[model samples]
Target: MKGNDHLITAKAPGKLYIAGEYAVVETGYPSIIVALDQFVTVEISRSKSFGSIVSKQYREDSVFWRRQGDQMILDNRDNTFNYIISAIRLTEEYAQTLGRRMAVYDLRVNSDLDSPNGKKYGLGSSAAVTVATVKALCEFYQIPLTKSKLFKLSAIAHLDVQGNGSLGDVAASVYGGWIAYQSFDRNWLMAAHRQQSLTELVDQPWPNLTITQLTPPENLRLIIGWTGSPASTSHLVDKVAISKSRQHETYNQFLIDSKRCLNDLIDGFKNGSLSTIQAGIQKNREILKRLADFSKVQIETPTLKKMCDIAVAHSAAAKSSGAGGGDCGIVVIDKNQNIKSLIKRWEENGITRLSLRVHPVIDLAKETK
Candidate 1:
């Protein structure tokens, strides 16, 4: 193989959920996710020798990276960029283990998400950056990293940064389509007995269905409302774990119902059945209410709930996308509805609205330079 010395850049978009959140973390649940137009970009150029991966951002100053080895490195100065470095190191190691030469390149990353702009919309900026890094590295090294492998590797990097993370975000980033994910015991994370238990679950394949992207009717609209408060998703997940440990039946039931509702929503999406979608969204909201009361308590801020109420009043299906404690909400507008009027009302109430057109699953390999 000829070693090509060239610069390659790649971008990966952020995502939002149509259904399933907490349930997606538990086993036997399906979650639906769509890639948003917002994205993160990585620029990779050949270098004389491996030194450090330098990173720069709008809100932060230039930060130099650290080297771990020809395979791995650590950059603790910036928590946000550390995961990107970690993914690059791991990908390099994987390539070497297979008797391939790893590319030595310098990378520059930039994100256009609203997180740093004081908006802090929870749109998986971290996962998007990780996806971009992995894509860029694969291109530079000429490594054939499959989408599934990319999802698994990115999930590991996410856990490294957030302690524990659901695969939903990374799956959405790498696959660029709707996905349903559940946490099963992997040998890497499981103890002897737990590993055995996970084997039983792993024996059965995870059930996932990708939603078909539909052409939006002229009146259909998507409104993204910012709640004006930053959410700590990791903290909320930990809280749920603790609550489940106490054998809270109500919380457990919410998780179960969430799984069911998510499946229904997936079916609705696949069949283009809006009625089923509407019903599933309503059921999902009910389950979220129960979970919010039991597990997160203050998970939904007053402003967010009010926004949901407004959308419901307008015959729209709406809910908070992620570990909801005041982040962003997704509203599905009816084709016969007045989208402009709804946007006007939201803006008048200080909520930011964004228009998005859904498309088919993105081809991640095509994104490689």
Candidate 2:
């Protein structure tokens, strides 16, 4: 696909949160995210007339759009393609600034992040698809972009549609592997986007945003267990935001505690201390539980709790992964730990252990045309 200049293809890996779920939504808060093996792939090819967007995940539905000046007017009423449309609009806007000509193209997406039954696994598919769409469009338009520019463009597109998220998933998708991420100020970006050019915004430093790749301890093993339920990350984040507005002091403390916990977890990775890493996971779980209790939100469901308990019984540290209302739980244990018993227990309790590995970093330098 890289050698094919006529067709542009891009794959963005899904992500799972290791720590700092709710707190990471706030500006300047840090989180740890890992890019998963599963991905959402986007492929773009030139079209004769109007462009159509189709996805394998949504077999029956497709979106037809034609450019009117700079805006893409969707011909259909279905809103499932909003993220893709947003990505295209933003990417083309950036491309136009480079004096590139826009051409009609057919875009198709195939995702492996969901279950065969169309059940979402809470693996950040939306973010992955958005990043993939942006990357594909950039390539199709012959716009050279660094990984950072790609991330910013993708994040901007996602925020335009979703309006809420930490975009840690976007960072993980862009820079794959394990990453320690600090969220940028969306408020600042929104304001800047209105006043500044798209190219200028991508080139400028986004305040409070920082991404650093981290090398996990060689002995550390990551396990993901699904609760067979789907979670709405945006809805959960909105609920937490409302809760934060009501309980100012408590939310502030949570932000501080999450930062400290993430720092310790990153240090664990740096020092190769499996014990410290496990301890950090445990602490983060406790903090999330407390936040759930006070916010009156179900961050961790009963099934997730059972899964975590089962992992602990097997001497592993476990916690709910994303905006967990019951989707997936992550376990961090030493490589030497026997996980067979844990898997068996999870299976007995209706938890499905997912077979996924961390995706390695992508070389963005090669993306240049």
Local accuracy by lDDT, each model:
0.67, 0.91
Tens-place lDDT per residue, model 1, 1-369, is 225476678887788766777776665566777777777888888766554455556435344443445544444455556677667755665556556665456778777665556466788888898888877777777767667667655665665566665667777777664554555433344343234442232233333423234333344456678877778788888888888777678767887788778777767766777777777877887788888777655666777787788888888988887888878888877677667766777777777765544434677656552
How many residue pairs clash per model?
A: 2, 0
lDDT of 1: 0.67
Q: What is the C-alpha RMSD of each candidate to the true structure, in Å?
A: 4.2, 1.5
**Positional deviation of 324 in candidate 1, in angstroms?**
0.7
Q: How do all models score by TM-score?
A: 0.85, 0.97
Residue 211 lDDT in candidate 1: 25
Off by over 4 Å in 2: 1-5, 366-369
